[model samples]
Target chain A: MNVLVYGAGQLAQMMYLAGAPLNLNVLAVDVANKTVVHPVEKTVLPQSLEQAINDADVLTVEFEHVPEELLLVAEESGKLSPNLQSILVGADRVREKHLLESLNIANCEHEIITDIAQLDGICERLGEKIIFKSSRDGYDGYGQWRSSTAADLPELKNIFTKLDLHKVPIVAEKMCPFTRELSLLGARNESGEIVVYPLAQNTHHEGQLHTSIAPAPLLSEALQAQALDIFTRLAEKLEYVGVLAVELFEHDGVLLVNELAPRVHNSGHWSMHGADTCQFENHLRAVCALPLGSTEHGPAAAMINIIGCNTFSKNFLSISGVHFHWYGKTVREKRKMGHINVTANSYADLADKFGNLSEYLPMEFFPKLLADADRIK
Target chain B: MNVLVYGAGQLAQMMYLAGAPLNLNVLAVDVANKTVVHPVEKTVLPQSLEQAINDADVLTVEFEHVPEELLLVAEESGKLSPNLQSILVGADRVREKHLLESLNIANCEHEIITDIAQLDGICERLGEKIIFKSSRDGYDGYGQWRSSTAADLPELKNIFTKLDLHKVPIVAEKMCPFTRELSLLGARNESGEIVVYPLAQNTHHEGQLHTSIAPAPLLSEALQAQALDIFTRLAEKLEYVGVLAVELFEHDGVLLVNELAPRVHNSGHWSMHGADTCQFENHLRAVCALPLGSTEHGPAAAMINIIGCNTFSKNFLSISGVHFHWYGKTVREKRKMGHINVTANSYADLADKFGNLSEYLPMEFFPKLLADADRIK
Candidate 1:
């Protein structure tokens, strides 16, 4: 079977790797250049995007931000998995919030603001502290504004005016004093068979993911149940037929939906080394309508993102349980070059290895990781 | 860094997959066509073989049977790892036998026969039971002839005469009465650091590898020590700087060297899912002169070759611990298409999963696997 991915990025590269072992041909479309590259075969034959899509048995996306025109074309072909509506919901915060509210999912209290006048009394009405995010085209802390206190309102208003909130509304959310960030990754096939991975505790640096620990050490059964319940409800409600990641916030032992990513996620990268079947492979399986693989976790595992650096010594492999995954991309500031996934017999052992691994990583990209590792014991 | 592989077969394809996460560009040379294909980027741009070799930081072989002319070119560039002489020794049975004798390695008693006349008294002098092997270009039971009794000498001599034994001498070996087959895989870097994987118990069918169980189920410390000692001696002797596989025969509790493969071997495929570092990745590391990763084995693992079949349902993945590796080759009778690697907490669990996995594979290609799985308990 052939699969056409919408975005030609690192995620597509990984999906290509995973598909090779299943006798599936995974081709990625360069959305901008309109070219197709077979990530495993490493070949860019002379084929148009329309021809490639027509040849593919199914169409999927590596990320949610694919151009709407391209998605509409794929939707017309009736081969796109997770559907166009789900992709739009993931792409636009306004649509996503509306869907969450309709489903009665407990999310952060928020209001949509299209004009500066709507922000006049928003601080008083909601709270002094709130985060404003662009309704569309934002990621990794970009296109976001925050009000630390009432005194910062003028600066927030200035930022809102600069962002041209009239063209794209902003989602003004009440900042919740949550305990920690967590994410749950799950897949549902066309047959409605769903499999959810263990909840992963995540840590972010400058709004970009830095570390993820699977099965979330010291997790309560109630939390696990709640995460799965949320995943099942959302997956059924959307009739999703591929991997979906739901980022959440933990407050007073209750989980609240933070956001949704409609694709294989970085936080789930630990599954490559720590689970029986990885998220990438499971995503392909769901898209192809194959039986889902097991989602059982290894004893313990952790993933550390290799951001903005690709010059580490291979000596890091000398550490017992450390596995490096370098995305073949040119290095640049703030770029996610790759990641490392480590598995161990116990959470303590994983933490110990993570600590040892941190010594080899660039301090600039891994400070949050080092702190997290030190707290493992 | 870039690596140029000698062959564009599945081994090279796998090496490409392993190298991608290391930020290394792995390109394979189609020996016959002299065309280069990048495995990960899947692009076949117009580049001469010399230019590809010049661009590569290191040169390695996917299979030891690479054309000698190509090896000479890579050798002249001073980029070939494990060196050209070692590859010749692996390719020619005569050279292999001489090396084993010089190193005092235990091997089957054998005599080199240049002509049919030299084979006249070979059977009588050695034993009624003997096996004849071509000194070059032979694998998977091809170029092999066996005599079970003295009466079969005339037919063997007739077949030998037809084979034109003058150009390439045949090594007449006495068939050792052995208990089982085993193999050891090890990697050596230019820095002289060597790490060996645990000896694996192997089973062959029709002279092709069928299944491998890592840590050899019920291994003795003495057997492991003996295997590692042999590997260390051979690696040091060859000044080897890449992965090597030593196929051995166990007879009366002692190990006898059967043959050696200068590249990754089928018996080591289990490491893909069962070892901390797979043989392919370690081979790339050694070739690139990087620190070798750990060779620690998972608790228990098994690998079953998927010969001449790609029709199995993906439902096989529904079985816990099963990981499929399809080679993306067109189906052909008796051809090695791909394999399945499974890992579990214990040998018994591995065995149980193996039994469950067999139900999904074709009986024609996996009869021996079914029988072996039945005996796992």
Candidate 2:
């Protein structure tokens, strides 16, 4: 079977690798050029995008933010998985909020500001701490703002007023004070069979995912059950047919939906070694209508992103269960170069591996390395 | 780093997949045409063999049967691991026998026959039960024959008389029989760091490998250590810098050397799911001079070759720890199309999985599966 993914990035490259052993020929469309390409090499393939789509048994996206025009064309093919609305929901915060509301899913209390004037008394309505985010991605001057007090509202408004709110609205969310971020990666096949990998606790640095510890250490069964229930409701409601990532915030033993990614997620990358079936394989399986593999994980696993700095050598791989994955990308400031997946006998062992991992990585880049390692125990 | 492998087949394809994650660009030399090609697609690359050799940081072979002419050129590049001798030893039974003899290795008593006339009373010298094998591959009428008594010698001679024994020669050996076949896969890196996966018990049907149970259930420590010792000796003698496989015949709690492969071997395929590092990745790591990975295996594992059978579906993948790998070849009688790697909690669990696996595999093709499954425990 042929699977055509809409973005030629690391995710697609991973999907290609995962699909190969299963005899699934995965091709990618470089959304930037709208041309079919080999995901790994990022080299243009000898086929038009239309030809690729027509040849593909299933069409999917590596990223939810695929160009609306391209997505429309793909959706019209009647082969796109997760469907258009689900993808739009992932791409647009407003749409995502509506999805949560429609499903009665637990999420951060928020309000959508379609117009600039709606910002008036927004802090009072929401909370003292409000996080204002651009409802949709890929727009000029789109960014986020945080409001702590009423005094900072003017400066936040000054930054927000420059944007065309009518074109790309603002989602004002009352910042929920949570313990930590966790993401559940699950897949819904065409047959409506659902399988979810263990939830992974994510640690972010500068708004980018730095690391993920799977099975989210110390997580209560209730929290896990809650996440699963929410995922089932969302997937069934959307009739989702592919891997869906639900970012959640756990507060006082309650789980709240923070965001959604309608594709294989970075947090779940540990599954490549940790779980019996990886997210990429499950995603391809779901989209291709193959049997969903078991989401069972063996040992405690963690994924650490190799961001920006390329100073590390292959020496750290000397550690057992340390699998290095380089995306083969050129080094740039804050660019996601690659990642490392580590499997350990226990959480304490993982913590030790994490501490040992710090010795190899540039300390300036991985600021949380040793601290997080020490914290894991 | 680029690793050029000779012989564009499933082995090379697997090597490509394993190398990709470590940022190793693996390409294959289709020895028949002497052209560089993508291992997975078998598509001719834009580069010539010379360019591939020049560009590769290391050169290796997926199959020892790579044409000597190509091996010579790869050797000239001063990058081929295991070197020319090791690969030649694997390609020719005579050279392998010589290697074992020189190393004082234990093997079946054998005689080299350069002339068909030398076969006189061969059954008396070796035994009534003797096996005659062509010393080299890739020649007309190169095959194995057995003789049970003096009565069968005349017919065996009749068959051997047609060949030019002066060039290829024949190896007549006492057919040692006792217990099952097992193979040890190990790697020696540039720094002389060696690691060996646990011995894998092999089952053969009609001279073709049918199944491999890893950690070779209930193996004695002494036997395992003996295999590891012999492997260490052979690898050190050759100063081997890649994965080396030693096929053994276990008799009376002793392991006698049967054959050697200079590259990855089929028996080690179970490592794809069972061990901390797969043979392909370890082969790449060895050749790339990277640190060797742990040989730790997680559970009882088995690898079943999908020989000439394309009757199975993806449904069997629903079995947890069942990993399917298709070579994407058109099935032909007695040809290897792909393989399945299964990991189980125990030998009993493995047996149950094997029985379950037979339901999906064509019974006629996998005739030994159920029987072997029953015998595992």
Candidate 3:
């Protein structure tokens, strides 16, 4: 079967590798140029984007923010998935908040603001401290504003007005002191059979994901169940097919929705070596209407992100049990370079081995010296 | 590091896949035409074989029968592994039998018959029941003769004389009735570190391996230990580097060496999904002077060979936990098409799943009807 994925990026490249043995023909379209190319074939140009979509048995997106018009074309032919409405929810905070509220899901109390005057009302309703976020194109802590006190709110509101907040409505949320961040990656087939991978504990630095540990050691059974419950409710509500990642913040003992990704996600990259089926392969299987793979963990896993620089001179290749995935991307400042998955017999052992990662990893990139030590330990 | 392998068959393809993530650049050299190519890059050109060899950090073979001149070049450069002597022992029965005898290892009783007169002397010494084998280029039950009666012996001797057996030399053996077949896949590094995976119970049809079960289910502890002993001794004797596979036969409870593969063997294919580090990866690691990967099995795994003519149908996509690997070979008659690995919680469960393989797999291509049933129970 042929599959056309919108966006030619690392995720699409990995999907191509996983699909090869199954005899699944895959062409990735870089919407900007409307050029279709194979990830590994690297040089083989296929039909035009429109022609490729016409030949595909299924069409999907690597990222949610694909242009609406292109998505409409795919949807018109009944091929696009998670569908346009679902993609919009993930792209726009206003729609995302509405969906969560409609489902009665717990999220930080918030209000949509379109103008400086609306921001003042939102601050009054939320609290003295509020986080302002653009409803669209905001990611990695970008397109945001913060008001710590009532006196500061008016100035922040003025700044929002100058930026034309009304043109792109913002979601103002009450800032909460959450203890930890967790994420649930679950998949559902068209048949509605759903499977949830274990919750993952995520850590980030400089607004980019730093690492994630699977089965999120020390997570209570109640917390895991609650995360899965939230995923099941959202997946069923959207009639979702393929993998969905729901980011959560644990405030006190309650989990609040932070964000939702309607496609395979970064937090689940550990599954490539740790789980019975990787999220990419499972997503492909689910989208192809095949039985979902077993999501059981084979070993305790820890994933550390490789960001921007590649100068860790300790020789990553020297370590046993380390699987490095280089995305073959041209490195730029703060760009995601690749990741390393370390699997061990036990969570404690994995932590212990990773503690010595500095011996092989270049430490200059990870500025949080103590944080690295604490994480692996 | 770059490695130039001397064959472009399945073994070379698997080695290429295993070496890729390690950033090891592996180029396959077509021995027939002396052309060089990369499996993933899939580019072939008329470069001098010597140039490809000069480009590699190390030189190796997927199979042992590379032309002696190529082996000599690699040997002169101190890059060839298992060396020409060790590889020649595996390729020629005369040298293999002589080496075993010199080491005081018990093997099938045989005589080196050069003519019809020598055959009669062989029968007089080892009795009427015997097998005749060519000293070189024999595999998959090819290039050998079998005689059960005296009348057949005269014609076999005549055939040997016609082929000028004296110049090539041939080994005649007293055929032994063996209860079962097994193999040991082990690796030895340049630093003298050795790691052996569990012995595998193998079943063959028409001399081609059909399936393998790890830990050789139901075997006594003594036999397993003896198998390891044989492997250790053989590895040390040749100072072998990289993975070596030793095929064995069990007569009653005693194990006897059948054949040896100096590279990753078909019997170890299960390691891809079953073991922590597959044989192919470990072989690459050893050859590159890198740390070895774990060989721990996730669960009892049963690997079924998908030979030619047994094509995958549309419904084949429905089998969960079944990992399929298809080699893009165009030839259809009796080829090693691909393989399907089915991992289960237990041996019985795996056997039960293997039984249902026919529903998704075409069965006529397999010579033995009970192959699916007897794989792993």
Question: In the order shown, what is each candidate's alpha-carbon RMSD?
Answer: 2.5, 1.1, 3.5
Q: Candidate 1: list runs displaced more than 4 Å.
A: A40-45, A115-117, A138-142, A158-167, B38-45, B115-117, B138-142, B162-166
* Residue pairs that clash (backbone atoms under 3 angstroms), model 1: A41-B42, A42-B41, A42-B42, A42-B43, A43-B42, A43-B43
Q: Write the per-residue lDDT of candidate 2 for residues A44-113, one digit (tens) a residue.
A: 8899999899999899999999999999999999999979999999999998999899988989999998
Q: What tens digits encode model 3's per-residue C-alpha lDDT throughout A1-377?
A: 78888888777877776665565666788877778876543444747877888899988888888887888898888977667777778888999999999999999998888766675456568888888888988333338878888888777756675665656788889997798888999889899988888988888887888888887877788998999899999999988988889999998878999999988889999988888788887788777877777787854786787888866542454465677776666788888778888777776677666766766776666555337447646
If both were scored by DockQ, which would come out higher, candidate 1 or candidate 3? 1
What is the C-alpha DockQ of each candidate?
Answer: 0.62, 0.83, 0.40
Give chain A TM for each model in order. 0.96, 0.98, 0.94
Give the candidate number with the greatest lDDT: 2
Residue A189 in candidate 3, Cα distance off native in Å: 2.5
Error of model 1, residue B347, in angstroms: 2.8
lDDT of 2 by residue, B224-256 (tens): 999999999999988898999999999999889
* TM-score (all chains, Cα) for each model: 0.95, 0.99, 0.89
- Which residue pairs show backbone clashes in model 3? none
List model 3's recovered fraction of native interface contacts, to 2 decimals: 0.35
Query: Which residue segments of model 2 deviate by more than 4 Å?
Result: none
Which lDDT tens digits does candidate 1 get at residues B1-377?
Answer: 89999888889888988888887788999887778976533446578899999999999998888878889999999999979988999999999999999999999999998877887777678998999888987433338788888889888777776665667888999999998899999999999999999999898998889999998867899999999999999999999999999999999889999999999989999998888789999999899977898887778888889998777776888787788888877899889999999988888788788778867777789868766765566
Better of 1 and 2 by lDDT: 2
